[model samples]
Target: MTTLLSVQDLAVARGLRTLEGVSFALAEGQAIILRGPNGLGKTTLLRTLAGLQPVAAGQVVHEPSALAYAGHADGLKSALSVTENLRFWAGVFGRTEVGPAIERMNLSNLAARPAHMLSAGQKRRLGLARLLVTGRKVWLLDEPTVSLDTQSVALFAGVLRDHLGAGGAALIATHIDLGLPEGRILDLTPFRADPARKAPRGDGPVGFNEAFA
Candidate 1:
C-alpha cells in the first residue's frame, strides 16, 4: 500500500521537554495506535504532526492537505445545530454534502439540535463526525473515545474500520482498545528524549506542557 504519512526521527517538544527519536510510516488502509503512559508526549507528537505546533527536530513528510486532525475539543460552533456544524466544515473543505457523515456518526437523530445543548459524549461524537467531511486521506486523532459509552465506542470503531477499508490511514492516541484486529501499536516509552540533554529555551510564551501544568 502507498504511504500516507512518514515520520523520520521526529522529535516533538512539549514546552522545554522533548520526546525524540520517534519514527514511523502510515500507509493507506493502516491504523497505528499510539501507546504510552501519561506525560509521555503522545498528544505532543500528534500536535506536531498535525502542524499545530512546531517540531523540535527531524521531519514529517506528507502531501499538503492530506491530514485531518481531531483533538479533545469538539471544534464546533456552539450556536450551530449538529447538521449546520457539519455543513460548515464540509463547506470549508469544499464538500457540499454532510448527510452521509451525519448518518455514519449516528448523529441523524440529533441533527437539528444546537451544539451547546448536547451532552459531553454527544459533543464528542459531533467532533469526530467532522473528520468524515474533511475528505482527507490521513487522520490524526487524540483520545477520540473520550466520554463515549460502550455502544458509541463500538460505533466509532465501526466507522474507523470503514475509513481504513476505504483506503484511509489513522494515527490515534487512545487508551482503550478500538478492536481493530489489524491495527499496530507504537509505544513511545523507548523513544523518550534524553532527560539529560538540555532543552533549548524558547523565546516565545510557554507551550503546551507549561499550560497544562
Candidate 2:
C-alpha cells in the first residue's frame, strides 16, 4: 500500500487543552481503531482531519482527493428523504450517484422515506452511507457505531472491511469493537489532560501517511 496521509505533532483544544503531542501516519487500505476515554480528543482529531476544525501546528501531508471523514451526530436533514440527502452528499462530494453507498449501508428500502421517519439505526446507516459518495482512500470516523444495532453494525463492518480490501484506509474512533481484519489500535487518552501538549486543541493537524505499523 502507498502512503495516504501523514500527521505530525498534532494537538487539539477547546478553550482548554483536549490533547497534544499526537503523531502518526496512515497508508492506503489499512484500518486503525482509535481508543480513548471520553474527552481525550478522539472526536476532535477526526473533525480536525475532516477540515471541520482548525489546526494549530504541524503538517498533515495527504493526497487531497483521498479522504472522507465522519462524526457522530451527523444527522441527516429530518425533513428530507433518504434519497434527497444522498443526492445532497453526492453533489457535495462531486459523486455521480448514491448507488453503492446506499446498498452498502442497507438503505435501499428506506431510500424514499423522510429522514425523521427512520429509526435510530436506520438513520445512522443513512449518515454513514455518505462515505461512499467520495472516492477517497482515507476515512476518518468518530463513533461510527453510535446507533447501529448488532446486525447493522456487522453489516457496516463488512462494508468497511471491503473498503480496506480495495486499498482504502480508515481511522476510526469508537468505544465498540469494529471487527476489522488486520486492523491496528491506538489509545488517544494517554496523550491528554491535555497530556503532551504539542499543538493547540480543537484545530488543524496533519493526516498520517504511515500510521498502521
Candidate 3:
C-alpha cells in the first residue's frame, strides 16, 4: 500500500517547540492517534499536513487530489441553509447527489435548517457530512467526535470505518475514544515540556484545526 502522508523529523515552533523529530508514515486504511497536553502542536501538525501552516523543519509529502480536511470549527457558512451548505460542499468536491451524503451522515431530515439554527451536535454532523462528498483518499480530522451524541458518534465511526475499508487513510487528533480496533500512536506531551516552544492559539479554543488551502 502507498503511504498517503509522511512526516520525517517534523518540528513546528513559534515560541515553543511542540513536536521534535516526530516522524511517521500513514498508509491507506490506517489511522493514527495523537495524544498530548494542552500546548502541544497536534493541531499545528494537522494544519501543516493540510498545507495551511508552514513547516519550520522536516517534510510532508502527499499525493495531489487525495486530500480532505475537517477541523473543530465545523467550517460551515452560518448564512447558508443546510441544503445550501451541502450544495456548496458538493460543488466544491464535484460530487453528485446531496441525497446519498445526507442519508449516509444521518442528516437527511435537517437539510432545510440553517446551520447556526442547529444544535451543536447537528452542526458537527453537517461538518462531517462533507467527508462523503470530498471523495478524497486521505482525510485529516481534528477532534472529529466532538459535539456528537452517542448514536451520531457511532454512525460517524461506522462512516470512518467504511472510508478506511475503501483504502482511504486518516489522521485524527482526539481525546474521545474512537473504538477502532487498531491505530498508531504518537504522544505530543514531551514536545510541549519546552517552555520556549509554545503553540499557536485561535480557531476552536485550544483544539486541532486542519486547514486545507
Candidate 4:
C-alpha cells in the first residue's frame, strides 16, 4: 500500500495544447484508469508520467527505478524474433531472466518467430510482455489494448491482475473496459486547458475548449 508515485498539480502540454490541474497518487497494488475524450491530453499525461516528455508545470515524484512506460507504438524490433526482442529488453533493463516473462505472455510457442511475422494481437502481447522484463513498480500504459482480441484482452487482464497481485501498480490510459477486479477511475475532462487563452496558430488540434468556442 506504499505510494509509488505522486503527481501534484501537474500541467502536461503538447505544443499549444495543455492539460492542467492534474494531481494523483498511485499506491502499490492499485491501478488507475485514465478516462477522457480524445485529445484531452491522456497520452500527454502518460508521457509526462513516464518522464519521456517535460511537464509544463507542477511536480512529479517517483523513484527512478520504479517506472516503466508502454506507448501506442510497441517498442519491438521487427527484424528480431519474439525471444530476441524480449532478450534485448531484458538486457537493456538489466534483468537476467526472460523465461517467466515469455511464459506469462503465453508467447512460448512464438519464441522463435520474428516480430514482423506475428499478427497484430500477438505483437501487442509481445509489447506488453516487455513490461515484465523491467521489473518496474509502476507501469504507465497508453491504450494497452489497441489490437487485441477477446482472448488476448483476457490474457492482458490476467497479466495486469497478476502484476497488481505482486504489488505493482499501473496507470492505464484506455477507452475499453479492462475488467480489472479493483481500481479507480480518473477522468481528465475537468483538467482541460483554459479556453480563454488562445493557443498559437496551428500549434495543435482544437480541444474541448476550441470545439465549443
Candidate 5:
C-alpha cells in the first residue's frame, strides 16, 4: 500500500511537557487507533501531526494538502445550515458538491437546519462529514466518536471503511471500539515524556500538564 503519512522519532509538545520517541507511518487504506490514558499527550501528538502545533523534535512527512484534521471542536459555523456549512468546506477544498457528504452522514433531513440548532451528537457527525468533502487521503481525527450514539458510531465506521476502501487512511485518537477489525492500535503510554527530565529550551517543559498529572 502507498504510504500516506510518515512520522519518524517525532516529539510532540503540550504546554511544558513533551511526548518523545514517537514514530509511526500510515499507509493508504489503513487505520491506526491511538491508545493511552488521559494526559498521555495523545491530543498533543495528533495536533502535532495535523500541523496545528509545532513539533518539538523529529519529522512528519506527507503532502501538504493530503491531511484533514478533526479535533475536539466541531469547526462549524453556527449561523450556517448543515448544507451551507458543507458547501463552504467543499469550496475550500476546491470542490463544489456537498450532496454525497450530506447523505453519507445521514444529515439529509437536517441539511437545511442551522448548525446551532443541532444536538451535540449531530454537530459531531457534521464535523466528521467535513472530512468527506476534504478529498484528503490522510485523516487526523481526535476523539471522533465523542458525542456519537451507537448507531451513529456504526454509521461512521461504515463511512471510514468506505474511505479506506477508496485508498484513504486515518490516524484516529479515540477510546471506544470503532468496530474496525483491521485497524491497528498504537499505545502512547510508552512514549510519555519523563517528568524529571528537562526538555531542551524552547521545546517546552519536561512534565505533563498539571491537569493531566
Candidate 6:
C-alpha cells in the first residue's frame, strides 16, 4: 500500500511544553489507535496530525487536502438543522452528496431537527457524519466514540472499516474500543513531555505539519 503520512522524530509543544519524541508512518488502509493516559498529549498529537496545530520540530509529509480531522469540539452550528449542517460541510469539502453521509450516520430521521435539539449522542453522530463528505485520504479523530451509544459505535466502526477498504488511513486518539480489532495501537505515554519545561514564546497558527511541533 502507498504511504499516506510520515512523521519523523516529531516534537509537539503545548505552550512551550514539548511532548516526547514521536515517529510513525500511516500507510493506505491502515489505522493506528492512539493509546495513552490522560495529559499525555493524545489530543495534542491528533490536533498536530490534523494540521489544526503546528509541530515544533520534525517533518510531516502528506498531500494537500488529504486529511480530515474531528476533535473534541463538534464543529456544528446549533441553529442549523442536521441536514443543513451536513450540507454546509459538504459544500466546504467540495462534495455534492449529503444524503449518503446523513444516512450513513442514521441521521435521516433527524435531518430536519435543529442541531441544538439533538442529544449528545446525536450530535456526535452528526460530527462523525461530517467526515464522510470530506473525501480526504487520512482521518485524524480525537475521541470519536464519545457520547456514542453501543449501536452508534458499531456504526462508526463500520464506517471506519469502509474507509480503510477504500484505501483511507486513520490515526484515532480514543480511550474507548472502536471495534477495530485489526487496528494497531500507538501509545503516547512514552513520548510525554516534562512538566518542568518553560512555556514557548508565541502560539503559532494551527495547521497539518505545524500542530504538535
How well does each candidate superpose onto the true structure, as a TM-score? 0.93, 0.88, 0.87, 0.91, 0.92, 0.92
How displaced is residue 85 in candidate 6, in Å? 0.4
CA lDDT of each candidate? 0.87, 0.77, 0.79, 0.84, 0.85, 0.84
Residue-wise C-alpha lDDT for candidate 4, range 1-213, written one tens digit per residue: 799999999877777546888999999999999998998889888876776666677899988789888888777889999999989888878987888989998999999999999999999999999998998989888899999998888889999999999999999998778888778999999999985555444443223221000
Residue-by-residue lDDT tens digits, candidate 2, 1-213: 688888898766644567667888888778888987776778777776766667655667888677787776755789999989888878877877888788889889988899999998898889888888877778888888888899998998998898899888999998788777668988887767533444444444444421210
Instruction: Report model 1's TM-score to 2 decimal places.
Output: 0.93
Q: Write the per-residue lDDT of candidate 1 for residues 1-213, one digit (tens) a residue.
A: 899999999887765555898999999999999999998989888877887777788899998899988887888889999999999889988897899999998999999999999999999899899999999999899999999999999999999999999999999999899999769999999988887765556512334532100
- Model 1 Cα shift for residue 153 (angstroms): 0.2
lDDT of 3: 0.79
Top model by lDDT, which number?
1
Candidate 2, residue 34: Cα displacement in angstroms equals 0.7
Give the per-residue lDDT of model 5 (tens digit) for 22-119: 98899989999999998888888877777666688898999879988887888788999999999988888898888999999999999999999999
lDDT (10s digit) by residue, model 6, range 1-213:
899999998877778655757899999989999988787778777777776666777788998888898887778889999999988888988888899999999999999999999999999999889999889989998888899999999999999999998999999988778777558998877777777875456645453432111
What is the C-alpha local distance difference test score of candidate 4?
A: 0.84
Candidates arranged by lDDT, highest first? 1, 5, 4, 6, 3, 2
Candidate 5 shows a clash count of: 1
In model 2, how large is the Cα lDDT of residue 199?
42
For model 5, the superposed segments whose C-alpha errors exceed 4 Å read 198-213
Instruction: State the local distance difference test value for candidate 1.
Output: 0.87
TM-score comparison, 3 vs 5, better candidate: 5
Worst 10 residues of 1 by lDDT: 204-213
